[model samples]
Target: MYIGRAVIAGYTNEKKVFLGYILASMSFPKRRARIDEESIKIEPLKTADYNNPYITYNCMKKVEKDKAVVSNGIHTDVIANKLDSGYSGRDAIAISLFAMDYEKDEYNTPRIAACFDNRSLYIGIIEKEKIIIDKVRNDRCMLISTYNKTVPEEISIKRSTAKDIAKELCMLDYEHIICSAVVCRREENDFEFATEEKNRL
Candidate 1:
């Protein structure tokens, strides 16, 4: 199914915290995930239309030693800042999604996000009709998407490494897979990240 941009968070069998972000877009297939030392950003390969504010933004960010935030738009930074400022994962996600509301595009696309630390997991979505922030179990992988799969649901995660987890998420039965990224906590303030783009397959 096509769930648009999505964020997944949970713990691997080894008990390490992991977060994955997938950019599944039919409209912006030319986009790719750019990974750096600090964050992962989704950017268009070429300058097409910058007016669509939702198309380019940081998709994942580590705000603190134990906290990270992932989202489909600019709220990624907003949520991360809130976490950096000492808010709990639940409060940061809820307040950011509530203030940002949904994207103002033609589709009124919902804003989906996940904030996670070593001990807690929170996923949220802000749609035109409603807003949801759910604190989910850290023992199981939970997914939230901008489209059809707007709610958080548990999913199986067989892979443990960052690269394998990212590729596995991109290979899911979802449609229009553009790129995927995974962030895994190795230790306090240490993280391993990897990304997979469809064109590189």
Candidate 2:
């Protein structure tokens, strides 16, 4: 459980945007049991004092040591799936096309019951709470690959600990490997990302 503020610094040095590259899941990566030699050089950064501005309101307030208002750290989020049970983020946006409501042609459509649609819907519910989800970036983007070709048991156990997996990925790549949620800092131009504490669905 990665419980504190984390700053994942890999190769997201893009001037005005954040990026993520998929890393193979330790248990299911293609051929290799570990990160490829090329992807292992990426580094994870420690977010010092609310460096990432995409955390929960309570988290941001604690970091800022300020008053906690309803909107203290609220913002519109565009959540989308970065991985599937068997794929990585090589072309997440293109892949998300399937998450959209084909009938409505809306990306991250509010209603779709398939597991894939479920992931997109989960993001939508997060937005209802005022978080922003980035759903529109087409073609060849970056992601920390976690779809490693290990064993299913190892993968299940690893996925259970979001913080640890996130930390591991952060340690191996650039850009913040955002989970279900991240906090937006009021003063700094950064974000505090974490998975949702409450995953009802």
User: Which candidate should be chosen as best, given lDDT against the real structure?
Assistant: 1
Worst lDDT run of 10 residues, candidate 2, spans: 69-78
lDDT of 2 by residue, 1-201 (tens): 211122111112132122121222221112111122111111122342333322222211111221110111121111122332333222332344334322231222121110112111111111111222233232212221111211111111122132333344444332322322222222333332232312111
TM-score attained by model 2: 0.19
Tens-digit per-residue lDDT, 175-200, candidate 1: 99999998888877788888998767
Predicted structure 1, TM vs. truth: 0.95
Q: List, in order, the clash count of every candidate structure.
A: 0, 55
CA error at residue 186 for candidate 2, angstroms: 30
Over 4 Å off, model 1: 47-51
C-alpha RMSD by candidate, in order: 1.4, 18.5
